[model samples]
Target chain A: MSTDLLTEDQREALQELVNIGMGQAGASIAQVLDEFVKLSIPRISSVAAANLSQEIVRLVGDADVSAIRQAFTTEFRGEAIVIYPEQSMAGLHEVMGYDADTKENKGEILLDIGNILVGACVGGIANLLGMLSAFSAPTLIADQTPAYRLLKPEHIQARVALLVEVYFVLEERDFRCHLIILMPETDILALGQALDRFVDGI
Target chain B: MPLSILVADDSSIARKMLIKALPAHWDITVAQAADGNQALAACRQGNVDVMFLDLTMPDLDGYGVLQAHRDEDLNGLVIVVSADIQEQAQVRVRELGAIAFIQKPVDAGKIERVLKEYGIQL
Candidate 1:
């Protein structure tokens, strides 16, 4: 049984991989918004499943928010989630070319954006890792409670993930989201092979 | 043959994407490999000038392939084109004799810059 989810090197390499995925995700969202959307420098950390919610809460902050979680399967299976701060919804709508007070279903639009970001990110990761993976439709996790809990079912097998904090910014408005990618079942050899490439000088 | 270039990646989509990013004035024999092992094999066949490689692959991932290249002192220049964009990966690939690192969602500008850095015209 493996004790650690990732070595420093593996985390670094995975971070780099996630960076590209996040970049693609951010780019997709920017395209839809038709504005200069800035993406923050992404970070990857390994926290146990037990502590994942705490980490999520810390990153998510205490704000009214909405979330979209999507489960994906490839050679390894896991989920990709994006949580949005509620205050930014109006700004997003405006940036997306909608009138500020338009009666359009904001939740539906949120899900659509999540779907595009998650799909592009997952596709980029799969394309990089050389594995075929498919992501399920995004599911809303409500606006009142912390959305990370939606991912922590009793049967969840992913022990760790490369946590990417993705923020979309346009001028004065900032929309924050978290892209959590869970690592699936893998033999020790597979894990080691995946990480060994970046161990140099580490 | 003007110059042979090996495009190595696990994803057919990515490989095609890299190929499509090549400039119009470029004239080279573009070889394709689906995994690191095949990438190494391409090097063994010789006369390859540049390799656009991805780090994570099924059999013999990029690091292993790069190590093999180092051990055998392969002549082809390795240009890592991957989604792994960490500085550590970039440094490691450079140490392994890769000449450049281009992150994925690769564009023509990046490709052109790396090609110019290596003195490969067009």
Candidate 2:
């Protein structure tokens, strides 16, 4: 798939969809944590599949981080990855009201957060686009590892990676995480078609 | 006089969708802004009678725009049009003097109802 899979209008439309999705995601997190979640304008970009690890590095840098991966399928097919720096993992316990003593406790909180974020965010976008998407159980991928190490090019068989960057921050706590929705090259065309239909309907 | 409306959002497609969702029979002149600064610029120029603002934007978010609108004492009535539907977000916008708040994927019927409820006749 070429980098020009989505035209300018389609890209803009998708970005708005991501924004709407992120907003819903933020609301869910705010409700769960009993705090306001500050939202940022979602950034959308596509890169060659082989260069995806580099892109992840660019976003989260080479810091030791923990990540959660959840897969969703429908017209939109991909994994939603949430990356948090290792140092911030402790703050999740205080924010989520979990005891920070046991590794199992930390992992449980991470999975729960991952599920809420991916299900709400991705589900929000899918809903806006009128697509029914199903989410797989979120899994804790790696802890205390660089993000790029988890998302190698060969691991993702897609020719093009559509990255929608949205970060979640709790106003009252020191909790923040970066969300990246990586769709395969084949699905890029499908997503483009879906976006065109959405634009046309408007 | 036609109602001078400004739709400020980073997405061109969202702006278009919002315009499409506006009541067709209302006599209105529309303006566009892609960020908070541009929205503020339009407000400063006295080009906005009713402003539809989005919360999460690039340079300046909608909250900053509303703060500036209050500080600068601009004459435009602001209705926040945003996807960020947190209860706190709504409260903050209202605190900043936005007249109303509308959710994203703009619905025409909702827009009409909001406008009517606010007694904004065009």
Candidate 3:
């Protein structure tokens, strides 16, 4: 269970750290859109590799969504997945200041947004926790696919996933996307220890 | 009299970090609220002289609390401490009546500097 992986205090500390990281991510997106972005309180849990698809369906409710994945390594190793509902692209297009002619380039735009958000957020958390990390360029994992069908068979090879979910919304324009950070169980112990050190220092 | 300080954030760790970042030499009484509703309740009871608030929370975020503060004419100086460091968020908080804004992963130096700059006497 997620609770067993980290003590109550460690989990709380990790959640707070994730909050700071997501805030940086929100700020970066806000800058790009030149608007205020609403941020959600981040939620963390551990899911078995086999349950990954079920978990995605649970969070996103089987909607047709566009998803991107960026892998990060070093002390923190895992993938940062950004999922956006298909309908949000129009809003994103308008808010991003892209004209009709450039609408076809929306995929590129999504990848860019994914890159900025994942980089700023994951990077912010790493810095706060004193972990060094490097990120690969983001790739499109799924385009307007059912949430449950988003992940490939090979992606579920990990024994367990440390799932962190945070959402960013541009309320007025009705655009929103979610970021899920998944670290394999192999790194969970290290993360738990880091959280402990962080709490102790505080 | 010791200043009554309230740290309002959904995250317990964030509250702790903010409390730790407070000036060690200052004489103050601290209160904590895990959400903005609790923050407003504390203000209504005249318990908070200065508030360190987070913008994102489970219910009634910092902006909601600030709006209510203005609506109720509540007494307390509000300082927003949040990870949402966008210029718009900052401007919105200022317009909503916050005295200052501090970004998260807050440090002692930043807290002290903001306090000093705002003429908040310890």
Best by DockQ: 2
Q: Order the numbered candidates by lDDT, best leading.
A: 2, 3, 1
What DockQ values do the models have?
Answer: 0.09, 0.88, 0.82
Clashing pairs in 2: none
Global CA lDDT computed for model 3: 0.85
* Model 3 misplacement above 4 A: A1-4, A97-104, A152-154
- What stretches of model 2 exceed 4 Å from their correct place? none
Model 2 lDDT tens row, B56-100: 888798999999999999998899998999999999999999988
Cα displacement (angstroms), candidate 3, residue A134, comes to 0.4
Q: Provide the TM-score, chain A, model 1.
A: 0.79
Model 3: DockQ score:
0.82
> Per-residue lDDT for B17-42 in model 1, tens only?
67878876788889999898889988
Native contacts conserved, per model: 0.15, 0.93, 0.88
**Residue B94 error, candidate 3, Å:** 1.3
Worst 10 residues of 2 chain A by lDDT: A87-96
Clashing pairs in 3: none
